[model samples]
Target: MMDIVKNKTETSNSVWHVEHATLAEWQAVMAWAKDEGWDMGLGDANAFFEVDDQGFFIGYLGKEPVAAMSIVNYSSSFSFLGHYLVSPTYRGQGYGLKLCQSAFAHGGDRCMGLDGMPAQVDNYAKWGFAGGRNNLRMVGQVQQDYHCPDYIELVQAADIDDIVAYDKSCTGIDRSALLKHWFIGETRYGFICRTGQEVTGIVGVRQSQDGYRVGPLFANTPDLVEPLFVAALSAVPQGRQVTLDVPEKADPTLIKLAEKHGFESIFHTLRMYRGEPPKEQEHKVWCIASLELG
Candidate 1:
């Protein structure tokens, strides 16, 4: 669906090699992602590699990079597939399938999840992905007049451990590495709502190629969602484009809240699983991290 062969001119004959990409070589895939309108975060290259260094795979036609895919094994029971792409020069030659199989083989028998474009849903089904749910990418410059609750505070260094633990409790997946990358100064910002030392909720927003993206919005109770969301959006300058990837199965109130704040559905990705899906606390999550990494 990304039009892999959109403007390419390539020789008909070719051979491809698939292998893990080092942190430096991974930058090439990021470049291609930018070319394809992925809108990934600036520090994603380093942060994603930390999840599983050997998880990022690249397929090369001789010495030139042609395709890339990432299957990050966050835990032995869970792996997430993302960044699937093929160069414009190499479509119609089965190279994408080759790269996909290579990435999938790395997951072995673990449940693999991915958020894919609608055009590829059937192909993914044939490859064993099913149970698709739409994850809407909501965009808007939300305006909030309410003052931040005293319980809500900017994420501090000391809050990292609790935030990581809280995320695991809510999502049933340990993505501490990616969460850690959220407070890396300028690129990302985070806020946590606490009640007498108890973490009530947390949200993170990061700069992206397209706009500021708010994700992984989790709460202990539904009451905590709005404050955390308001706090995160407050970090972005007024009128800047902001995005939130909200799963179709999230709490109904969260959907209404997003809609009430002037946010509109720009597009959506289909969240599918290749095996047993994660048993996350859906009601507590307002948005997921980017589809490419979630």
Candidate 2:
């Protein structure tokens, strides 16, 4: 639990104090995301905290929490801003901007990126985030009857090194800590595609607030993606909906795979960056890890 200690910089006239969130406070932030209709993975907070404990932030009006945001520094050259929210009661008081500023200060000199809600794109633009690709969130029921490819196999602890390497190649970000927690958990399932001893693709599905979510789906080519996708959905319980976010400019066949599996576009966010976007292998990324973490 977080101790509610007053900072030395706090002044009597200040309406709110911004500080890094403790583990318990981070859980509160994830709960807020769920309440806002965001389908978050059950173990996201734990994995996220391990990535960068100082990344999460919360604002408080004395003892009451009012705002939250995250600025995860992937490396000296890159960072991602996300989990931004301001309590309804505190709107128009500049609390969100204060929190945003804190994040910016914490990520000095690094290129920052965010998945901004469509309605807030203009507001983010004012803060230097230039719009890039659109990320579409698609949802659909798992097709239990689909045949699983014989080449696809369940991920094991031994496969961690290869998986991490493949992920780094796809995203251009080192997230080994996050992947460790995300891949080895009771509520999650991970699958890999191989061409005889070499990993060619990988995907993971985890229990979410509403159902299941498949993400970080990466493959060397479109042909290797479908099998991994089908294998992931097959691990989920029958009749449960599975959601995934895909970059709009991804290979057209990737979208067709979603449609073939009965998925529909439910919502979207603008992928914006404050500096040069990371030189990622976008064509290999069939699905993103999560909007909150990215």
Best by lDDT: 2
Looking at model 1, residue 226 earns an lDDT score of 85
Give the root-mean-square deviation of each candidate in angstroms.
4.8, 2.5
Cα lDDT of model 2 by residue, 141-228, tens digit: 9756655678898888998888988898888888787898676687887898988887899999999999998988999988888888
Residue-pair clash count for candidate 2: 0
Where does the lowest 10-residue lDDT sum fall in candidate 1? 1-10
- After superposition, candidate 2 runs with Cα above 4 Å error: 1-14, 143-147
Q: Estimate each model's TM-score.
A: 0.89, 0.92
Give all candidates' CA lDDT scores.
0.80, 0.83
